[model samples]
Target: MPDSKYAAYQPAAPYFDLVRRALGDRVDGAHFFDLVTDETVYEVLYDVPGWPRVITGRDALMAAFRGYVGAIALESADRLVVHVADGGAVIVIEYEVRGTILASGVRYANRFCSIITIGNRKIVHWRDYMDSLAAWAALTAPRGV
Candidate 1:
């Protein structure tokens, strides 16, 4: 059965399903741009080891994602659990990123808790939280020989 908490929200389930489907393996960075509304705003708040509070808009967000993708040869997410509140939703997901950095093979895994707010069937706000130390180590650590 579907989550009962989302029963009161008319568009949350469909919107969430759409986002999940759009993020599958065949999709790329451009797909996210298409899924999001032109006026959509995504705010990512993270306090990494060396970085302070980072707040970015749509364009900057896109660029950041692109850079990460460029650094990884392949990336996929699984173990997605969705929770729907009366007026909001949250998705807990785990992701594995595999690729070579400067010709050195490396693989990094991370878990994320994403909070999403919907308005008019579109995501009005998105805030993601993850362990920055794990990410930093993955991006900088030496790969297997």
Candidate 2:
């Protein structure tokens, strides 16, 4: 369980685990939300229903994550490939997540590539790319396991 202060970020746990491993000792944050700047901008390159294409501010991101958890419960996040550039100011991470749709028991899987820009040891900007078709298939899966 996430601390009450970051309760809204519970959905990020799986992904954060991968990030923490990749960024080992590069950033200081016990939780995923803590690694983001208050004014952080998060952008999604692909359109996934129930998800915004662009999100600004860690608070806004928190709300978005809340909605995400309600729709899907992640089982695992892995396959991390990290690339550092510009003396650690910019990093690219590719990963995959597996989960189950809440409304149905349908399994969900998708891969992601995120380009992150850091400032003052916090994530200031994020541009994300994901397998939208795979997500849509899971979202539209037949109800009931």
Candidate 3:
């Protein structure tokens, strides 16, 4: 059973749980989509000049995720913090991903911080932050192991 306050919000625990399962391990694609509202929006901000921020709706977001599916293996969430307020929820998740690049077979390890907003028990918005230079270096540098 889910929290009573979230009863009206369709697809409650299953939605958020799936993300934990999907990213922490491997899971079916359909499961991931179940949690996202049709109008869900995602943004990735970068501080670098000339680097355009990424803003896209559900379909585009899914597409972008698909491109990285097999390219990186999301290992686990390090610090997952959640805050619920006035009919809305925000989750801050820090995670590590490691795998070989599909194109170069170079091993990579990187960390990410994602902030997700939920409304009506469905995800409405998401923003992610990561060290781009660290990601690039990890992907191209020699493996520690």
Best by the TM-score measure = 2
lDDT of 2 at 88: 95
**Candidate 2: residue 85 lDDT (0-100):** 97
- Scored against the true structure, residue 44 in model 1 reaches a CA lDDT of 51
TM-score winner between 1 and 2, please give it: 2
Please provide, for model 1 over 31-78, each residue's C-alpha lDDT reduced to its tens digit, 9 standing for 90 to 100: 344445556566556655333344345565555555444454443345
Ranking by TM-score: 2, 3, 1
lDDT of 3 by residue, 1-145 (tens): 2345333322223334435453432222334455565687777775433233674565665555554543444432344444444444676666555555555656665567777776665667778788888667655655442
TM-score of candidate 1 relative to the true fold: 0.60
Candidate 1, run of 10 with poorest lDDT: 6-15
Decide which is better by lDDT, 2 or 3: 2
Distance (Å) between predicted and true CA of 33, model 2?
Answer: 0.3
**Where does candidate 1 clash, by residue pair?**
none
Model 2 misplacement above 4 A = 1-4, 7-11
Worst 10 residues of 2 by lDDT: 1-10
Residue 103 miss distance in model 3 (angstroms):
1.3
- After TM-score superposition, what is the CA distance of residue 113 in candidate 1 from its true location, in Å? 0.4
Question: Looking at candidate 3, what is the lDDT of residue 80?
Answer: 41
- Candidate 2 local lDDT, residue 101: 92
